[model samples]
Target: MNILFLTLAKISTLKERGIYHDLMREFSSHNHNVYIVSPIERREGQKTTEKKEGNATFLNVKTLNIQKTNFIEKGISTLTIEKLFLNAIKKYFSKVKFDLVIYSTPPITFTGVIKYIKQRDNAKSYLLLKDIFPQNAVDMQMLSKKGVLYKYFRNKEKELYNISDKIGCMSEANVKFVLNHNSYISKDKVEINPNSIDLQLVTDVSEENKKKIREKYQIPYNRKVFIYGGNLGRPQGIDFLIETLQAKSGDKDVFFVIVGSGTEYDKLKNWFDSFKPENALLFPAIPKSDYDLLVQSCDIGLIFLHKDFLIPNYPSRLLSYLEFKMPVLAATDSNTDIGTDIVKNNCGMAVHSDDIKSMINAIDTLKKMDGAKFEVLRQNSLNFLKKEFQVEQSYFKIIEA
Candidate 1:
């Protein structure tokens, strides 16, 4: 089978360890030829190019920066990407007859591309519904539902859904939301296909190595380290995270290690500069290998989402925490089931993002757990990862479509 994947994520090679890369590798390993159409943002100073790694071929389409840019620039980029991707597919993969067209969302402007493929090659289309678009923008008050821009994107969103033969949502909440909101979409077409990755055994970092990492980062060895390693953007509810740090400033036993960059990075950095919180340390995004080591060294994993969001967000970062056997602490909106799932599985605790007192209390709960109890939670995290987030599960789900 020849699979063509359309995505906004930049994938230079299939060797990289990411949700998409792992799933693509799974398809490739099964003797399928996977073709990817991903962006090469203008900031990368690269032209449209095609390359192959293993059984996958990546057609890197050149486009304006759609992420971490000003609203106007980001909007322009998002509006233009679909056309750019369609042109690239025609130029580079004109002869290839795709058996399946799998794509993810952020910009739901890929209806044209998908329609073309379905008509040209009679391909089966699957949507990896990662974001609930214009609605999410409206939830954050970034766009007005009454505005033209909202109408434009909303129409595109409908078109994209209509074109897809199947829609793979991240959670049950997402599937429900899609069905309720889009009455045109049949229930049989939607199912839970979460953010999954290739499972790797958790290896314990030696105490000496852990000590070296702590020393290198100036983290206290005796303190319980809670690490948040991902985009520090508006969707993450950065303001609440800042308030949490301020509230925990007096705690001497807990340390916060934040590592990520985004539009909200400066806001968080400014707060760190003003408060100089003794219990917290902030760093820009680090290399993946270094970040993996940091996750292993940390005592707790943290995830945050804006309380305003009505969309059910399931961040892939949870998988990282689980794969490393670290218990999680998710401060999220009520709509998302991520926090609830973690607690139900006995992997960790979840608190409402708007409730600072609840978050603080949850941290204290973690702090109070004895080594024996904490070890059980860590094992639960690993167990949840293996059961729910394996790349093979995602591969089978898409193929079954």
Candidate 2:
């Protein structure tokens, strides 16, 4: 199968440690020809071009810095992606035929591009639903549900849903949310394809290596490490996380290590500015090698969502932690469907989204567990991923369908 992928993310001969790259490699290993059209976020001196690595060929399309645009202007940025990305795809693959077009969504404006390709080549288009929009905006109060803006984007979203050959959601709740919103989409065409963790990359290292990593990061030689790594954005509900740190600053044994950046990065950094959390350490996003090492250095993993996120996420970070044989502590609502496995497998605990007391208690519970119990949790987490989210088993079914 020849697959065409479209996204606004920077994919340099495939991204350093991204979910899409994992699936692409898996597909390519099976002898599927993989061609990707990605967008480059313009930097001061960066170059734009295509690079080939392994079986995957990467092309960087022209894209606007939507980060600098206003809300309405940024919303329109999606359309430009369709125009630029499709142009890049056609210029590169004009004579080649794509068996399938897998369009990942956030801006949700690629419906036009997908439609154009389907008409031009008579191909199947799959909507890989990463972030459900309009509602996610509503959850963050970025857009009002009853406002004129909501009605307009809502229509745009519905149109996209109707055009896709199949919609693959990140979680069951995400699938349910889309079904509830639109009457035209059939149940047969929608499927649950969770955000993935590359199972093959999972590793278990000795305590000696963990100690070296801790020392390298200036983390304590002996202490419990609770890691919260990923995008520092509105949907993540970071204010509550900030307040949790403020309330629990006295806990010296447990260190909360934060990594990654986003629009709300400045807001998160401001609180870390003067106060300088003794119980917390902040690092800008690291490379995949370092990220894998960092996860192993920690004793427990964390997932957080703001209380207001009506359609919350089942963060792929959870799977990454599990892959490293680390237990999880998630602060999120039942809507996310994250904790059921934790409870059943005894991997960790779950607490309410904004309840700092509960979060602290979950941390304490993890700290109290013996090494044997910790190992049990880690093993269970890895076992769960092998059983549930193997990229080949999961994505093949989606693509073959």
Return the TM-score for each candidate structure. Answer: 0.99, 0.94
Residue-level lDDT tens digits of model 2 in 149-190: 788778878888888888888767788877887778899889
RMSD of each: 0.8, 2.0
Report, for every candidate in turn, its global Cα lDDT versus the true structure: 0.94, 0.78
Clashes of each: 0, 0
Angstrom error of the Cα, residue 154, model 2: value is 1.5
Alpha-carbon runs more than 4 Å astray in model 2: 44-48, 66-73
* Residue lDDT tens for model 1, 5-119: 9888889887779999999999999999999999999999989999988779999999999888888898999899989999999999999999999999988999989999999
Best by lDDT: 1
